[model samples]
Every structure is written in structure tokens, then in C-alpha cells.
Target chain A: MCVNMDLMATTLPLLDTAVAKCCAEPGSAPLDRDEADAVARLLKAVADPVRLQIISIVRCSEGGEVCACDLPSPLGLAQPTVSHHLKVLVDAGLLERERRGQWAWFSLVPERLELARRALGT
Target chain B: MCVNMDLMATTLPLLDTAVAKCCAEPGSAPLDRDEADAVARLLKAVADPVRLQIISIVRCSEGGEVCACDLPSPLGLAQPTVSHHLKVLVDAGLLERERRGQWAWFSLVPERLELARRALGT
Candidate 1:
């Protein structure tokens, strides 16, 4: 059976705690400490140059997903470094990772990106 | 003479270098190193919990702006600590700082937030 990683991630207890604590429209009112921390964690996940580039590349990929092997060349980083960045993104629920045979394929999590955008009040 | 701090920050040579390099619509194509770095800098500026709260407060303030003196009570932070976060936001061009005789008033720079939103492709 093919399990849906996105749904699984959303339902994970840890992510549920983090994601559920945020998403209040930032411009509508002052965010309390918990809301601010949750939003900040999401922003920090994408606050690195390599990670931002990775997100952009994944966002614009032709098939809507990219294999782990395909990312290093374009990012000009080694496999370990790229994998490290990918792990951070996955942990933050910004990217979904699927195992296809020996390699991992990564895809953007649109809802997470939308949550970050809304947190910015834009 | 009352000068417009937003315009001045937007035109500053250093800020111009950073802000001008990004905003290429992250979903359009892969972002180059410079573009990623620029956008990362902006994200890093607002990646902190205190800074995000400060931005939300200023954005939702009663007069479309807020006095520096009024921030501490809402934030439950010391004046110097709050001021540091304010400086980071101003330096990132995300907030405009205006001097009003004995205090500084902060307001949102809607364009910068929009740029960040676009960079996230939401």
C-alpha cells in the first residue's frame, strides 16, 4: 500500500503541534508567543541560501518532484550537504520526501508554503 | 525637515544590493546564488520570534504605526532588546523607522513583505 506522506506528515503529533499553533493572520492582530514561535520556526527552515535555492528548484521542477541525485549538480553542493538541507526542509514539513527504489524524491509542500506566506500577512 | 526613512532605506546602496538581487519569483526558475543569498538575508531578518511578533504588532497597530515606547509592554521585553529587533527589521527594509522628537515610530513596509511573499511563491 502506498501511504500518503503529506497526510502522514500533517497528522504527525509533532507537526500537528507546531502547525496548529500558527496560521492566524499576522496583520489582523498581535501574535502571542506560541504563534510567533511556530511561525518563526517555519521561516527559519527556509532562511538559508542553499535551502531557498533548493526550494525554488523543487518548486520549478518539470515533474513537480526531483530525485536526490539530481539536486546536487544544480545546487553545486555535495550529496551530503544537499541531503542535510533536504532533511531540514522535510523536518519543517516544507518538503515531502518519497522513497522510489534506492533514491529519494522530493516535492514541495504547497500548504506549508502558503502557511508561511499567510504568517507574513501578505 | 522630516525625512522619509522608508525611501532612504530602499535607496541605500547596501540594501539596494541585497533587495535588487532577489524577487525573481521562486517558482519561475532556479534562483542563482546571489538571488538566493539576497532572499535568504531578508528571510533571516524576520526569522526570529520576537521580530515576527514585532512586525505583527506594527502591522496591526491602531494608527498604522506604533511608538517604540509602547512596544515593551506588549512584547514583555526590555527596551534595548526590543530596539535590537526593530533595528534588524529596519535594516532589512521590512519596517520604516521615523523619528518623532523624543521617540521612534515604526510602520510596516508593505512592499518588502510582498517581496518576501513572492519569493516564497505563495
Candidate 2:
């Protein structure tokens, strides 16, 4: 278990780096195609109404974390639909998921969201 | 002509109000459908690579504006494609366009971008 945990730690930074590289400030300079593509991918992840609401709900939840099971009713979405949106956010590095018993709980990946905010360069 | 200008002035705030109403801080609370939809539309406008690059280039340009004709080469896109992206940005209120002779110039609408930044609540 310790070896498995060590391996997991080593792999996570690589994902963070990928997110960071794509989120370079857009107002700082003209973005090349690759930078633009990466940044756009991040934006697209949050570009849907359902996804935007999901992020908002997760961010504002008490203790800064929310359970996947608790999301659907407030969102007025079905379970599968909410799950799909959560998956998209998790894939985007905007949210991290942890399994607690039989259910997954989510917390904001604050750094990733900050990178997205800065990428907008407002 | 003065009446036309006055009419334009009178009409613009309603549009601004609409944009403003929808861009409320997302982290403040869960977003209702309309607010989420409006925010999503703004995100969608900037959610493409070419459009994101256009925004960056325009923001970084001298005098805070760029002519429509100058965008294609840097973006490696054709004029018509660039124009379509510009229209999307303008329609979303993230950009304002001015016609100077035969060329159209574009500049950022700082407030709109700021609202988007705040909406992200990072």
C-alpha cells in the first residue's frame, strides 16, 4: 500500500504540469496554436450551463467538498446526467475526487481554477 | 442624428444590465438556470482556440485595439474565419468593434472580462 501511494504521488504532478502549461496568461502575449488549444479545452470543460452550475455548487458547498450523490437534487438533474458532468470536471483537473466507502466525494482543485482564471487575463 | 445617438445610448444599458445580471459571482451561491446559461454563453464565445488567441492578441496590441485585417496572418487563419470569430466575441459583449474607413478595429470590453473573472470566483 505504501508503494502504491508513492507511485500515485509521482504520477499526479505530471497531470498538474499539463494543466499549468496550457493555462499561461492570455493577456501576457499572443498564444500559439498549442497554448490556445490547451486553454480552450479548459474553457470548454466549463462552458456548459450544467457544468458551470456544478462547479458553482461544488465551490460553495460547506467544508469545500461535496458528495456525488448529493449533487443531483439541487441541480434538478438526473443521477446519470450529474455524474457525466462531474466526470468532465474531474477529467479537466478542476475537481479532484476521492472515494469514501461506496461514494465519491469531490473538492475543488483550487490551483487549476486559478490557472483558468489567470488564463482569461481579465 | 442626435436622436439616433441618444436612442443608442438609451438602449445600451439594458444590454449591459442583462450581461451584468447574469454574471453574478458564481461562488457566492448555486446558479439558477438563467444565470448559468448566460455565463455559459460568455464562456462559449471564448471557448475556441482561435477566439482565445484573437482576444489575447487584441489585448496585447498597441493602443489596446487591433484591426480585423491584421488578425489572419498571426492566427494562421483566413480573413473570413477570423471575421466569424470576431463576430462571436462582439455578440457576446466581450469585444467592441469600430469601423475606421474600410477596416474594422476590435478592442476588449474590460468590464465584461472582469465580470467573467469574478464569476470564476478564484
Candidate 3:
């Protein structure tokens, strides 16, 4: 069962592990279950083609934001499909959403990506 | 329909886009379907809790390598389960494996993670 860990900000290791060094030597402690789950959730969010494209669209957008309506046409996907991808990204904390009028604008969260990059055991 | 683009290294975008700048402008071209697929494949490999823990364990090993037989105890998982995760990481180019005697040793692939990092639209 998936736990809604959103509210327990103090408990999640995202911030702590974000700057943690990669495992470079043997005998190091393994990633605990919660740490692995937290990192995996971030990775899963970017594990889809549609989501990756959606992230790229939002990240590339000038003014650091893109409207929900502008996403589908460029990717050749349906509106609902695009919206779905956006929600997943938001939930993963990889993107931020702001509602303006009738449209939702999305922006990339570089810190989240950086945390994932560091987690790669690099 | 996952094509084995492995043999056709010339065709994969892993190299070109690895250095490509993130989409930082609104009118920037979206990531092509192929690029998205390739990046997603890499992400999918690390999108699971078990896989992430496995990666961490292997990465932390000394001499930049870890024996497959030594994995299960630290992670408290079955041997076959740990092996399966190792295989997925190997297939995704995130981990490299070598055989010595009867054991398979796994090591981290920093370059692959670097590419995935750049692909995060960061």
C-alpha cells in the first residue's frame, strides 16, 4: 500500500539525501526501504515517454511556465493525456503548477531533478 | 514494441542529447518521441524501490564492485529478487557486470546516470 507521505515533510529523505554523497566504497550502509521508496517515486514519475516530453515542454517554456492548453498540440497527444502527465509530474514534486484564469501553467523543479541525479549512485 | 536499439548505437540519442541543454525557452522544440522513449527507458530501470536499493548497495561496494552473492543479506531480500534487479540495471546501461569464478560482480555506470540527469530537462 502506498502511503501519502506528502504531509510528513520532516520524515521524507528527499532533502537530506539530495546532497548526500553517492556510494563510492564497499561496506557502506544500504539505502533503507523508505529512502529507496522515496527515490523510486521520483524516478517513476519520469519513467514514461509522455511524462518526459511533458517535462521537457514545461522546462523549455520561456517565462519559466507553460499553459496546459499549449502542451497537447506540440506532442501530438490528447488534452486529457497531457493533463494526466502534468498531474503525475506535480505529484512527484518535479513540477509546480499554478492556475491562471482557466489554464494551468507548469514549471520545472530543478532541485527535485538534482536530488534524483545525486541519487543515481554517481 | 521495444526495439533493440542496442546494436544500433549510432541511432540512440543517449550521446547527443546527453550534452544538449535543457528546454529553457517557451518555443523550444519538444523532445522527439524517440528521445523521450530512450530517456524513459533509462528512468524505468531505476523507478522501483528494490532496484534503487540494489543500485545503492552495488555502488557502495569497495573496489567499485560487489559480488552478487553478497547482496541479499544486506538488503534482506531473496537472492533471485536481487539478481533480477541487477539484470534490469545491467540492461538499462546503469550497471556493468563482470563474471569472476561463479560470482557476478556489479558496478555503477556514472556516465549513464549523467545522461539521464541531463535528460531531466535540468
Question: Which candidate achieves the best DockQ against the true structure?
Answer: 3
B34-81 per-residue lDDT for model 2 (tens digits): 667767777788888888888878876768889999999999889999
Give the poorly placed runs of model 1, Cα more than 4 Å off: A1-28, B1-28
Tens-digit per-residue lDDT, A1-113, candidate 3: 03434532644455356326344456666677777777777788888988877777766666777889898888898998888888888877788889999998888788877
| Clash totals for all candidate models | 0, 0, 8
Query: Which prediction has more favorable lDDT, 2 or 3?
Result: 2
lDDT of 1: 0.76
For model 2, which pairs clash? none
Best candidate according to TM-score = 3
Candidate 1 lDDT, tens digit per residue, A1-120? 124456445445443344343333434567767667767878899999999888878866777788999988988999999999998898778899999999999998988888777667
lDDT of 1 by residue, B5-100 (tens): 554444454434444333334345577776687778888888888998888787666677899999999899999999989988988788988999
State in Å the error of residue B98, model 1. 0.9
TM-score of chain A of each: 0.77, 0.76, 0.82
Q: How many backbone overlaps does candidate 1 show?
A: 0
Looking at candidate 3 chain A, the ten consecutive residues that score lowest on lDDT are: A1-10
Q: Give me the candidate number with maximum lDDT.
A: 1
Candidate ranking under TM-score, highest first, comes to 3, 1, 2
Measured against the true two-chain complex, the DockQ scores of the candidates, in the order shown, are 0.47, 0.40, 0.66
